[model samples]
Target: DAGITQSPRHKVTETGTPVTLRCHQTENHRYMYWYRQDPGHGLRLIHYSYGVKDTDKGEVSDGYSVSRSKTEDFLLTLESATSSQTSVYFCAISRDEAYEQYFGPGTRLTVT
Candidate 1:
């Protein structure tokens, strides 16, 4: 697997605790993305990085944030983990705009 690794594969937390999930990639892909999978939203983007120091938010970036300091590392932080934020976080990468992506296993976060 030349992709990301999310620590704490599964987590159970109460409302209002800040949680930080990491995405470590082995591939040197330039474009990295973070997304959350939910019932109706399917997979909505949280944040993404175009290059080492260039990052941007996506459609559903609220309540979430991201950072990418190297070619193979991207981190997503939930300032305040809440019950409504319970979902699976996935990290993906695309070498080029026309290429397909590779997604990490997933991090299941449950906030009670």
Candidate 2:
């Protein structure tokens, strides 16, 4: 099983501020993903990493960027946070892209 954790479980910030969220895993999974969960949008992919230094944009990667410097850590940064970006963010890990993913507890970010 994959063990994942996110830092700063909750946060509140003003618009235009820069925010970065960290995701760490213990299982050394090869695939890591960042997603945001909202009431109506469900879970939307923000970015994903296939391996160390191998990252790619997802459907909602406009305002976000991700970097994976190591196998166990993936970081997501918001260039300029906005109210519309406020939501619950989750980190997921999977051995393969087609395999089942395990999610972290999540981080609640509120941008005012």
Per model, state how many residue pairs clash.
0, 0
Query: Worst 10-residue stretch by lDDT in candidate 1?
Result: 1-10
RMSD of 1: 1.3
**Off by more than 4 A, model 2:** none
Q: Over the stretch 1-112, how does candidate 2's per-residue lDDT look in tens digits?
A: 4589899899999999999999999998899999999998889999999999999988999999998999999999999999999999999999999999999999999999
Write one digit per residue (lDDT tens) for candidate 1, span 18-58. Answer: 88888888888898989999988789988988888889999
Per-model C-alpha RMSD: 1.3, 0.9
On TM-score, the candidate that comes out on top is 2
Question: 1, model 2: CA deviation in Å?
Answer: 6.5
* Model 1 ranges off by over 4 Å: none
